[model samples]
Target: MSTADTTDNAVRELLLVMPRLVGRVKRLPLPEQLRSLDLAPRHLSMLSLLLLDGPLTVSQLAGMLGVAPTTVSLIVSDLSRKGVLVRREDDADRRRRIIDISPDSRPAIAQWLSPGARAWRHALAPLSPAQQRIFVDTLLRYEAAVSTPTRTAPRRG
Candidate 1:
């Protein structure tokens, strides 16, 4: 077999695997502890975004989530009810409230995320130390690329 054919086959394999990886990421139970809390999907999304991006204004959240500002407000209200989010008045603009993650939820986030971390550790454990490092590094890069805001195109529906 020609070298170019091998390269093409490898690329095809990666294309096939990409969707499976994405499906798994979307299914992660990052807030399992609060699942019985019966929080809305939008509320949990707001908390996860804050955990990733730090505190942000409602406008920023709207932009990141590709939803209207009012939609973000509704989500924030739910999160507050769930005790996962808090409202902070912006000092520079007292009329504008900045949403922030609740301090109590931080520990919960860490604890809930530990399982995924351990899973990755186990998955990569069989590789040699150098190979494991490279594999882990590649996964980090893939995560950053996948999670970047620009990667989420607006839904047509």
Candidate 2:
């Protein structure tokens, strides 16, 4: 195969792998929520994504959540009314609006998605310092590879 063909195959592989990986990882939280909690998995997730990716528009949130923009807008509006996310209009553009996470909501996000934060804390108690370092390095390498951009048609900046 030509170099372009090889790159295309690799890109296809990544596209195939991404949804599986995301599906596996994304389901972890929904079932873990306690019976009495007010926040559904989707609400926690929207908050978590906002925390991780920074503030975003409804369209952007829809892309990340794999939902329609109308769905995202409803969720954002609900969160905004509840004061978990604060809505603000762009001063420069006036037309663009954004939803920012409220300061009071930070603790809720930590409770929801603390990264591998809990597991790492537990591992630290049992593993030697060197073993901990090795595990962390391996995890970081996996993260870097997954985060790298995949082959795609070129876009003009």
**Which stretches of candidate 2 lie above 4 Å from their native place?**
1-37, 115-157
lDDT of 1 at 121: 75
- Looking at model 2, the pairs that clash are none
lDDT of each residue in 22-109, candidate 2, tens digit only: 7865665533323244566688668777877888877778888889988888888877777678878867667877777888776656
Q: What is the TM-score (0 to 1) of candidate 2?
A: 0.49
Native-to-model Cα distance after best TM-score fit, residue 50 in candidate 2, in Å: 0.5
lDDT of 1 by residue, 1-157 (tens): 9999998998799889989986886677756666676665566566667776788999999998889999999888877887878899999999889888789877787566555567767888889999988987987896798798775678897
Q: How close is candidate 1 to the true structure, as a TM-score?
A: 0.56
- Per-candidate TM equals 0.56, 0.49
